[model samples]
Target: MEPGTARIAVDLLGGDDAPAVVVDGALRAMRADPDLHLLLVGPTEVADALIAALDPAERARITVRPVRSAVGMADHPSAARSESTVRAAVTAVRDGTADALVSAGATGATVTAAVLGLGRWPEIRQPALVATLPAVAGPVVLLDVGGSLEPRPATLARHAVLGAAYAAVAHSVVAPRVGLLSVGTEAGKGDRVRRATDPLLAVEPLPCGARYVGLVEGYDVALGARADVVVTDGFTGNVLLKAIEGAYAMAGGPPVGGGAPRAAALLGVAGTVVVCHGSARADDVASGIALAAHLWRRRATELVSALLDGDAATDRTDRSTDTEVRTS
Candidate 1:
């Protein structure tokens, strides 16, 4: 293997179009990165097909961890069993067999497995799933895409720090401007959660010299004119991300840079993990694997967590005052 090789464990049966899409994506990723190694976590037959397609020399870089069970999209997070493919991929990271993992499985199941197998960082009750969008102005890092569906004000505050650190460490964004997603830029324009979360973010000590830019609108997220890192509960972020992708599809193609990514990096977990959309295509799966390798090489997860430790007050979020916001 080349120096700094990133061995990524890929869940072969994770996506809506499994085995076939995954195999094709893995082939593309391996061909693109000379140093990339893969541990195919799925059925032996499925893994064999991929290996058979590769040249003998290239086949040496691949390993198979035969796991037949997979978590369906309709299944609950609790369905993440030790024998399942996603859980096995997490185990590879936890056991040092793989540097990171990529899964196009159920987001909740992947998050659950990562938390159960690798454990969460200190004081992170809800691990955020952060996605980077290549906007016209620059890269926009949005968090809680599908990790915590209904986070409290304190959780949103915590994720603000996570987004800031991720933007700086992973994307080389300096002094990231953080913002809470709201219906309007005006203060208190959103629901009770947005109004409550606004002040917490303003007072919260952000890492990487990040500053809270207060509330931002949907336009800010798409154009990247207002903030570098946008924080929101998982439900809204997830909905918004899909909507952006659909808009791009309707527009004939994405922008010159690219459109919304089908994959996101899971923060607050101890190991590097990339979660792709369940309906991910071959290119999306390839992008997810590439993201995993990139994160492992940068040691993004470790550095981001260390940044969190610098601010002792980040963990002091008083969740007792948190109330559920009505989405209706």
Candidate 2:
């Protein structure tokens, strides 16, 4: 762990098993990193239970944000109840009481909470959920895992930029090769959206010395011989991620190098946020927490945001010149 203290706000009521599983994950994380601090946002009793289990010294590193019933009520709805806890967690980050956030709740709810609390980056209409898969070559960055299920071609192109910058900034990959996820490696091989996005990505300026490699097939994602970053719409990306995870499990275990990861980094937001699979186990949660700490220490979010701004500026200039020439 880095020397700087990283305070993470965890949503105690966000998961299916919640509170219990979250408590276990939090305790594990606290024990793993000495400099880690957790702000548990949920019902007071649940937070207290976790604190009581920890040693006095360890307990001191934990804080609690009590959440009760919200104003709206229909004999106590499930959505409203969970929203209260997630909102409180978001509030902690917004108030600077926490450096980052980790949650295993519904993807849509988490995205909504983060957007409302931290605010989205300028010109990032649809925030992307980026997942890193440990490939034979190295880690492969895949984006739009669950954020913008049916994004436009422009959004797919934007995500390519985001994924490339993230891979370079967060993972320190040099000259990342970006690839559009399609049915085949051919130029015009996928659905209508992929076919349209291919040309756009080919022309889009990527940050961190990144370059577009046209189109890549699903096999290229795990093999990682073709591209370092894979971009696709959320619907396809989500399904593909799960299928890969399932394949790893069926093969007895993930490859020695690494398999598909359960946690993802939320890009296009102002803060470092990680969202784990809703069915995440204790180990998954612990990993998610660690990822957030790493990102916060590296200042990944701010650096990636700067990269996107630079790319956007370049795109604007290129478009303006093209329009001028066509008219003149």
Candidate 3:
């Protein structure tokens, strides 16, 4: 949608019904965005079929990077083979052949490939996966959907900062109110991690004019009345996200605006990467490609990193002043 050319590398063998689903999604994405250029990473035949589906005018927008292997859903992320399609796509972004990448691969494999290829931001022990849900109020940003399953309390606090910055930078949320996901809205309502994370978020220096809103219930995630950005550990966030999707399914359809996205942006890594559900449909894959292009065009990754850098500098100065006062 943005007014720039976004060259995206797509992993064709990353989904449950890959190559076919991925090819269809890539075709749909190419037609939707005139300025979108695709670097298809998969078997040569699959890429050829997708490119052949387009007219001559549209065909110029496509390129192919042949990769045969893929990471299966059951494979350990650490076992991601060197020749996997997801890894090739990561290489394309790292090599500047593509501005971003989208994959319906195993979330762990995608994250692992992106981190190893592009490197993570400083002090980011674990990168987070952020999803934007179209809530009743507006868009609600949720982080750690499936990045680090057993994150420490400190990681949750750090993710609060990431979520807040992402809401403002990516979604244009003003003065984003951030919340720690818990059983209730009370100050100390969750398990050990939430209890520890609440105090940290209360004092953390959030970027993009954001503020902490204490604990928020599960309903707040869909309603968006209590917070614009919700933070939690990856395991809980992943489960909650899937449950919300299931609820929308049981109800006939999603609410007016949209539902929980099948695609999530991987934060803390250096490159712009989108990870879709392993069971993604063609439209879901298309949306993932579009999301990657949107982030690249907006320079969302760079801007978010800059916000974190500013916060870090301010924190260092504050600490220095405190030490000076004590010594004086």
Candidate 4:
């Protein structure tokens, strides 16, 4: 709820429920924050429906960028019909019509659209989808949730730096402890990728006073006793996050303090982006909107980008010295 106005582009046909859920979430966000403005991007009828429902005074705060195509149409429908509303939403951000974007559609679709639209930062081979889980101690940042499915050791190491910077800039965690997700806490545990990543992270420079805490197991994720930032491959992280959500349900409910979070912040992109669980409810959508607002207000994306640039500079210096030694 910063004083400045934040225009968020809502993909009216992006979620599982499309216009209905999108409208509901938009209303909730509008009511909660007076400085928020929305640019609904989807079918004209759907945007009109929402606008018609709002009072005259509030209507001015909202605008519509109609995308006539239906939600789940066939691929390559046509440019007017071919491109998805999600892609259009990304275009809005690129063109500076919107400050951020939020979608609950397919993770792949959103990631693809954002990457193609905003362009990835230098040295970021694969963008990361970062999720912040509420821990008893504080918020724990998890990355590669669905962005990089099979990242190499270098990608994993880069994500660690990204996660660390995000935790500090987004959540204000001082001296965040970062951990590589693995089967055991031992140094040599987990698959080849994890094993290789553990040592790389140990020596990699981290931002915001963050330090690498070696390998951590799944149990550590929930307990939050070991690390404040957990890094892993997108495939494992995605499955693990969903499994924890299911486990919380089986146990009657999430722990009293906080449960598994359904919304995740998409990092490595140049915009303030949030991706909700595809099966998100109205409340989940609301939460995602709020999260997007929070990130934009804090200037989280810009700050994280600066941190990554610093890390890249460090990596370059290290590489130059190694090259010099070899030449000498």
Candidate 2 error regions (>4 Å): 70-80, 315-328
lDDT value for model 2: 0.85
**lDDT agreement with native, every candidate:** 0.87, 0.85, 0.87, 0.83
Tens-place lDDT digits, model 1, residues 1-328: 1247999999988877776898999999999888999999987888899999999879999999986454232252423422388888998999999999998888888999999999999989999999999988789999989899999999999999899989998888988999899988988799999999998887777777788999998988889999999999999999999999999999998999999999999999999999998888889999999999999888899998887776653343542221111000
lDDT of 4 by residue, 14-98 (tens): 6666558878888888888888889888877778888888888789999888765554453433232313888988999999999
Q: What is the lDDT of candidate 4?
A: 0.83
Model 1, 315: alpha-carbon shift in Å? 11
* lDDT per residue as tens, model 2, 1-328: 6778999988877666676788899889999999999998877888899999999999889998877663233245434556777778788888899999998877788899999889999879999999999888889999989999999999998898899889988999998999998888878898899889999998887778788988988998888899999998999889999999999999999998777888899999888898988888888888889999889988999999988776655645576653333222
TM-score order of candidates, top first: 3, 2, 4, 1
- TM value for model 2: 0.92
Superposition-based RMSD of candidate 3 using all C-alpha atoms, in angstroms: 4.4
Model 3, 220-271: lDDT tens per residue? Answer: 8889889999998889889999999999999988888988899999999999
Q: Output the lDDT of residue 81, model 2.
A: 57
Badly placed stretches (over 4 Å) of model 4 are 71-83, 315-328
Better of 3 and 4 by lDDT: 3
C-alpha RMSD values across all candidates:
6.4, 4.4, 4.4, 4.6
TM-score of 4: 0.91
